[model samples]
Each structure stands twice: as structure tokens, then as C-alpha cells.
Target: MFGNTLYVEKIQHALEQSNFPATPDNLYDPVRYMLSLSGKRIRPLLVLLGADLFNIENIDDALPASLAIEYFHNFSLVHDDIMDNAPLRRGKEAVHKKWNESVAILSGDALLVKAYEQLAFVKVEYIPELLRIFSQLAIEVCEGQQYDMDFESIDSITGDQYIEMIRLKTSVLLGGALEMGAIIANATLVDRKHINNFGVNLGIAFQLQDDILDVYGDPSTFGKQIAGDIIANKKTILYILLKSKLEQEDTQEFEDLLTNKAITSDEKITRMKNLYQKYHVVQEAGELKGKYTHLAYESLQKVNVTEPQKKELYSLADNLMRRTQ
Candidate 1:
């Protein structure tokens, strides 16, 4: 089986070769620009890896579906940046910032349409099931985004609600991508469900890792602005866990810090990090990430594939959890 490097290169080359119309520059340019940004491409990689797990001979058959997942992912990001009013994406100007919001919205809509267009090229036999999976994934992602926005307004949320939000907003696409590949490879229904479960659990772990990294990772390698979550007052696991552990006085103080407009962004980040350290939220977040990662491995173990066939996926999951970027 090909390793992750080869698969990533294949996906990159396919993206480079993707055809887009020239005349409608405003509508299509942001789509192209968004795709051009550097990303881990984890979701598309899941599709390819899922196919390989079943000993699919020509992994190229999975490319259209992979690209579909990618396009849809970028579409979400473009709109998400707008909603978050985030100025940067991948450390560059956001689509809404580089172009106008109108162009970004139209381009994002076009990317969703392009995702469906890529889905059309899947093997005829698999198209119907792929469509069904893709549609459900799309709706779930929207619902997850809505939940994320909703959380911003609510003062607090349970850890379970936070996990469910990330699972929907982020994890389901990973699960759906793997399921699509399994369908294309004609894997049995049981294997498909197991692999999807693996991806979902793994994706949750991945996002939790991200939540930690957002606060503590090296800005040069972490891709986006450091301490972004703290700056946005996002209700991350760290935030929730810290809040739960704080004394009554400290809880009120923490609320004051989050709403304090007088402090510099740097000051806010520093204070938040200090509070996180004091409360041991980072350590607790690491523990939670470990829990999900263990769950992912358990699911992966249930897949009906040979030990050798599972090596690459196991390696990929390890690398994902261990990644600094």
C-alpha cells in the first residue's frame, strides 16, 4: 500500500489540475484561491486511506470523491471566515478580506456546487450512496457551525455539548469521507461502519488537539494566529474545564477577563494562558484528547482488515495526534 506522503502528493496534483472556468473570475477566483491555500488535507486523505484499507487496486477511483470532500471543506472555511469575521486564513488574508464579502459568499456557494460536480464523476454504481452520504454530511456540518455560533452567545456549555458540537462541525466529514471510500471499494457494511466510527473518534481527538495547540503551539508552525480561541472567547474544552474548576471569586474574575476591553490582545492571551496553567486545563484537555484517541484505536481495531493492511492508517492516526501543525 502507498504511504500517506504519496497519497498527499497525488491529491495535491489532482487539485493543481482541477479545471475552473475563467470568465466568471469573481465567482470562481475565490474558490481557486481558497483551494490554493496550504492545508493538511486530512479529510481527503481519509477517503484515500479508507479505500486502501480494503485493498482497492486503483486508488485513483477514489480521487473524485476526495476532491469533493476537499471542495466542500474549503467552501465551509470561506463562509466560516466571514461569519467569524476572521481576517486571516492559513496565515493569509481571508477570502472575505482579500475580495469583498459578496464575492466571497458567491465563491463559497460556487465551491459547494463544484463539490457536487466532482461527486458526479464517482463510479456510476456508487453515485447514489455517495450522494446520500455527502448530503447528510453537508447538513450536519451546517448544523455544527450553527451550534458553534450559538455557543458564543451562551455563557457556558457542558463538555458533552462541546464534544457533540465539534463532532458535527468537524468530525462527521471525516467519517463520511471514509464511508464514501469504503462504498467505492465495495467493502462490507460492517467494515464501513467500523471505519467511519474510527474516523469520527479520530476527528474529535484531532480537534481537541487543535484546541490545545491554539493556545500553546508555536505560531510559526501552527498555521493560524496563536491564542486565537482565547482572543475570540471561544468555548473550547479548555475554557469549559477551567470554568468548572474555578472558585466562585475566580469564576467571576474569569468572566471579567474575557469581557475586559481595556487590555491589549497580548495581555489577554497572557492572562488566559496563566489562568489555564493555574487551573490545569491544558493537562485536562490532553487527557480528554487521549481518551478520544484511545476510542479511535478501539474502533480501528474492529475493522476487518489484515494487520499489515492497517499499518498505514495506524501510522497516519498517530501522526495526526502527534502533529505540531
Candidate 2:
């Protein structure tokens, strides 16, 4: 987190050293401005930490690829906001809302290109492997976004499909991120594979936790309304799974609650959520999330890294799984 001095300092140092200009007058100004907004920087830090975990002395050798991952992530968010018609991001106006969808989309595309530009800086010895993994992740993220869009239009979607969608959209990048770190350090194939597995499994748990928080987290901590997902009728795991739990009459009642042509904002929030609670859906979601978290730890333990190094990763994984956001 930015609260940590090393994490904050290294990222700041990386941004400062970047060839990207400082003046707000340039077309790329927004890129710098967006980066300056000071995110958690967890993804890049994961890269640094994972590399260091292998006792690699030259952390800088891997930093460019690490930053490329972060840039690609923000790029996805920019386009995603437009697709979702979301008004805010990180407690501020979304890029699409602040400017226009056209500008937001173009800016997002620029970020995507810049991610590869940064990747060019990664050491040549590792670039080929990095590109192979990174390209797969990039394509899968787009596929995941498409799947999410498909869910909105389709009436029937399996829980398996939902998991696959999020795995691609959200989890694969984290896996590639750690994998990139291992590649830069030239870690053993087994260690690299294990670390990547850790990242992917943790990512699944992270998104599931996000779904739970959307329906139940404290607003003060969440920075958004609890139950916002329910109001939108988003096909979260809780919603899809509980549809099977309800009896015929209860299913009809639930459908009626969501089928309103124009649902009253308050009623939408209340009815969908209370019904979720009635079905104990959040509890079931937690069970699924915990399973993934345990699997992440299991994979992490297989890595041949030192205990002290693994300890930090374990701590980070615990925080991520427990975080309300």
C-alpha cells in the first residue's frame, strides 16, 4: 500500500524517472495525471516483491515490465467505465464521465499501447517469455469483459461461466504479474509456476470478496453503496447461485422484484438485498471465496522460496482476501 514507505518511494521513483512529460498541455497529460492520483500500486509492488523474494539483487531489471502491468490494468478500467457507464472511479469522476466516452476510449487505447512501450524496456533475455504471458492475459481480459457484457443480455448463465469470466478478466493479470517477476529473476520453472498459481487463485478470491462487499460492506469503508450490485441486477455469484435455492413461488417473487420497468431506487436496493440475505447467499459466497484463498496458500507453499519471503506474500494475500474493497 502507499502507506508503506518502500512501496510508495519505489513507485514514485519509477514514475519520476519515466520519459512521460509533466506539462498538462500534452495529449498524454491525462496519463500522468491519472498515474499521479496515487493508487494502491499493489500490482507493481507484487512484481517487485515477487522478484525480491527470489533473492534477485537487480530489482530495476524487472520494474518496467511490472509498471507495464499497472498501466494495462488502468487502461482496462478506463474502457470498462465507459462500457458500464460508471460515473466515478476511485472516489472521483470517471474518465468517461469527466471528459467524454470518446476521449476515455481513446485514452484507454493509448494506455494499452503505452503498456507495450514500457514492456520494451524489460531486459531482452526475459522479453519473449514476458510477451507470451502478457499477450495471453491481455486477450483474456478483453474476453472476460465481453463475457460480463454477454451476461447482461442473456437470461441464463452458469456459475462456472461466471468464474471463468472473472478468472480471465481479473485473475490472469495477477498471475502474469507474479510470473513476470519470476521470469526477471530467472527463478526455477517450478517456483515460477507455483507463484503464478498463487496469484491466480488469490485473484479469484479477491473478486468474490468484491462481490460480497458490493452487497454488504460498510459504505464508509467501501466508498460506494452496499447492494449497488443488487440494484443493477448484476449477475454476481450470490444472485446466480441463489436462483436455484428458491422455490417456484419465491423465484417468481424475486423475478418480480427485479423485473420492474423502472424500479424505485430505494426498493431495488432493499428488496434484492433482503432476498439475498433470506437465502443466505453471502454466506455461500464466502465459502467459495475461502476455498480459493486456501488453494492460493497451498500453491504458495510449494514455491522453493525462503520462509521470510513467503511470509510477506502470505500477509499480503491475507489482507487482499480480507479487504472490503
Candidate 3:
């Protein structure tokens, strides 16, 4: 089985070797630039890990599908950055901030096309199923983004609703990546489904941790601006839990604080963190994350692979759930 380091190096090399046309520099350069940025590459790693569980020798067969997932992810980020009007991605200027919005849009569209082009490299026998999974995941991610936007305008959302939104917006792609790898390796339907479930559960836990860390993590280690979600008044799990525990008067006060644009971000973050601490919302969010993470491990245990073969994935999931960045 390939270690995480080997898989990371392999995916990095493949991405570096990816062929893009030289003409239409405006359209392609942003795609190239976005790909060039440093990211955790967790989705592709999940694909490779999923294949390795089946003891597949020619792991290279999974590369195209893995790259397809990666390209699609970057495509979403480019467009999302434009929509969020975010100034930075991965601690550097976002594609839209670095270039004009029109160029970012065109490049992002080109990336979606490129993702399909990468998928073409998969063996013909597996192409149909892989495409089906990829297409379905793509649509679900869009729906998730839409739900996120809709929640921004709505007055309230339940915790269950928030979980569903994250599952669609974030978890399905992780699940699909694992299933695609299983398809490439000719794994049984049962094993494939189990692996997909594992990825989905883990993805949710990861996102929940992200919500917790937004307010609690050290800015120096987080690599991006701290309290960005708080600054924007984005409804994270912490906010949802805190609101659920507060009285109507307190919840109204929280809303007033969120809407008071005159207050500095530091002030808002301080006030919100105080409320979160007062209500033990951070501790509650941690418990929720632990629940999903435990579920993920249970799903992993259902895979048919031997215990020894599962070590790498266990290590990866453990690290992911504990990450601060």
C-alpha cells in the first residue's frame, strides 16, 4: 500500500504533468494558477486510498478520476470565490481578486470542461459509472451551494437542516470520489457503498471542525483570516447551536450584533465568542463532530479489507478530524 507521502507526491506529479493548451492564455492561465496553489488535496487522496484498500497494484488507473475530482473542486472554488467576494484563498489573493471577474468566470468554466476531459482517460469499461457518479456529485455540490446562499437570507435554520446542507454541499463529493476509486478497482458493490459512506461521514466531521476552528483556532496556524465566518455572519454550526440555546431576547441581540456593520470585526468576534463560551456551544460542536467521526470509523470497519490495509486511511481520517487549518 502507498503511504500518504507517496500518494501526495504521485498526485502532485500528475497535476504538474497535466496538459493545457497555450493559446487563450486569459482563459487557461487562471485555471493553471488556481491549480498551482497549495491545497490539502484530500479528495484525490481519498480516491487513491479507496483503491488501495482493494489491494490494487496499478494505482495509476485511478489517477484520471482523481484528477477529475480535483479539477472539479478547483472549478467550484474559483466560482465560489467570486460569489463570496472573498479576497483570499489559501492565504493568497483569490483568482477573482488577482484577475478580473470575467476572466475568473471563463477560467472556472474551462476547468469544469477540463475535469470531464480528465475523466476521459479512465478505461472505457469504467467510464459510464464514473461519469454518472461525477455528474451526480457535481449537481449536489451546486444544490448545496444554493442552500447555503438561501440560508444566508432566511431568518432561521435547524441543526438538522444545516447538516443536510453540508452533506450535500461538501460530503457527496468525498463520497463520490471514494466510489469512483472503488469502481476503478472493480470492488464489490457492498464494499464500494461502505467506503463511500465512510468518506461522507468523515467529510461532515471535517466541516464541523472547520466551523469550530473559525472562531477558536490561532490565526498564525490557520493560514487564512480568522473569524471570517463570524465577520460575514455566516451561519456556522457554532452559530446554530448557540442560537438554539439562547432566549428570544438574547438571540435577537446576537442578530443585532451581526447586523451592526459599524462594529469592528474584532468586536463582533469577541462578543460572539463570549456568547459561545457562555453557552458551551464550542463544547457542543465538538461532541457533534465526534459523533460523525465515530460514524465514519464504523463505516470504515465495514469495508472488506484486512485491518493492516486500513491503517493508512485510519491515520488520514484521524489527522483530518484534528486539523486546525
Candidate 4:
């Protein structure tokens, strides 16, 4: 019966109390620093919400899984920043930039270890299934990351390929978090499958929303540089759709503009936005996001829980879909 705000507070308190070795400042400090950064904490919240759906009275039972998800997420961010050569994370200095790449790598590894350590505290009966799912989730995320990198080197990628990549990299973890919570509550297999599907579909929608925001969102609110995808020549859904819509000459121009170093970042962003608007790809992307959102709702509705029990998750999904950041 607790709301999202209370659940978030509980997660924050647990993170604050997490134990880390003090002497090896270089190794552990980056891990601590990365965790301290501002984030939505949506993944962990899903863990609690999943358990709450089953009417689990003592939410504390879900805390270990929540912490595990958070730790793994932050660990991914640390390494992802390094891979992207991103100087900022959560609008502050990135771990690699603040410290050094080697230290950041070590710290990120340490965080992954910490994530497993947290998983060790989950209820004994659920441990085996949780470990299996968590391990698979971890491997899939890596596959997604590798696919993303592979796309960077290629000329074109199908929308299906892109969707699959994002699913593995982003959506699976969300599903895993919720499923872990359901496992802890001893929910039936059918209910677990339904909730996990709900989360996976919702996560796809969430990432699509992110693609839109990256182009049009306010920099201050978005928590990252606007048109960063454009600058990096990322094959976002918008870019992919736009590429498909462009004629041969327009496609050539598009590629040239992206590769042109003479243009300033602002100029590149402005020009790209013009192209996106001209092709109406943003609207198309919105429609694609809506498709996944509908699928998510369908999955949630199929869950055995009563409508009243599902209200918070539905509200959270709505808010996430509408978010500007």
C-alpha cells in the first residue's frame, strides 16, 4: 500500500547504509561516487512495486533485490560512460573522467561484485531462480551493448535489429527486476510471466521516449546534452526512420551532414532537427513508442492481480511515458 515516494525513500536509505571497503579509496570511491549521483531509480522501484502487487506486507523482503538491481545498473553506467567517452553522467563528471579509466573499470567491476553480494541476501528459496535470471539478464545486457557497438560500424540497421538490441540491453533488466520480486513473493509461474512481459514492454516504450527526448528535450531538464545522439551519429529510431524516408540524394546529404566536422555541434543539431521535422520521423517514432506502450498495458491487464492492485504500476508507466527527461 506504500506509494512510489515511500519506496524510493526506502531504497535511498538502504543505499546510504551499504557497506564498502574504506581503505582502497581509488577502487571504491568511484563506485560510491557513481551511486551517489541523481537517477530516477525506476528499476529498483519496479522491484518493490512487483512485490507489492502480490500484497507482500513486509516490503523489506524485496530490499535486497532492489539494491542488487541498482548496483548492477550503476555498474553498467560506469562502463557505458567509458565506452561512449562521455564526460558527464547525471550532469556531473563521469567516473572515468573524474578518476581514470583503469580505476573506473576496477570500480565498475567491484560494483558488479557488490550486486551479486546483495543478491546473496535474498530469501533462500528464491535464490536459485533469481541467480539464473540475473545471470541471463547480465549476459543479455552485454550482448545488447555489443550489438550497439556493432551497429556503429555498419552502414544501416533494420528497425527490427535496433529493437532487438534495445530489448536485450535495456528492457530485459526491467523485466528481470520485476520477475525477481515476484519470485521472492512466491507468485505463480503464470503471474510471473505476465508481470515480466509488462515490464519488458514498458521498458521498450521508455527507451523510445528517450530517443524522442534526446532530440527535443530541454538540456537542463533532460540531464544530458541535447542532440547527443545526432552528434555521435547514433542510429536512433528517429534517425533510422528518417533514413528510410529520405530519397537517395537526401540520404547522401544526410550522411554527409553527419560526417561533416566543419559544422559546429549546434549547427549540426539544428540542421538535423530540421531534417527530422521535414520527414516527420518524430511523429513516427511516437507511434512506435505507443505500440510498445499498448503492449505493456495489455500484459499488465493479463496479470491475475485485481485492477486496484495494479493502479500504482499503471500510474508509473503513464508518468514515464509522458516524461520530458
Model 3, position 307, has a per-residue lDDT of: 98
lDDT of 3 by residue, 107-185 (tens): 9999999899888899899999888889999999999999998988887788889999999999999999988989999
TM-score of each: 0.93, 0.92, 0.94, 0.94
Q: Rate the local accuracy (lDDT) of all candidates.
A: 0.91, 0.82, 0.89, 0.90
How much is the lDDT of residue 255 in candidate 2?
Answer: 85
158-274: candidate 2 lDDT, tens digit per residue: 767888989998998898888888888889889989999899999998989999898788888887776877777788998887786777768776887778767786877787777
| Highest lDDT against the true fold, candidate | 1
Task: Name the TM-score of candidate 2.
Answer: 0.92
Question: By summed lDDT, which 10 consecutive residues of candidate 4 come out lowest?
Answer: 248-257
Provide backbone clash counts, one per model.
0, 0, 0, 0
Worst 10 residues of 3 by lDDT: 247-256
Better of 2 and 3 by lDDT: 3
For residue 62, model 3's alpha carbon misses the true position, in angstroms, by 0.7
Q: Over 4 Å off in model 2, which ranges?
A: 1-4, 21-26, 261-270
- State the number of backbone clashes in model 1: 0
Say what the RMSD of model 4 is: 1.8
Q: Estimate candidate 3's alpha-carbon lDDT, on a 0 to 1 scale.
A: 0.89
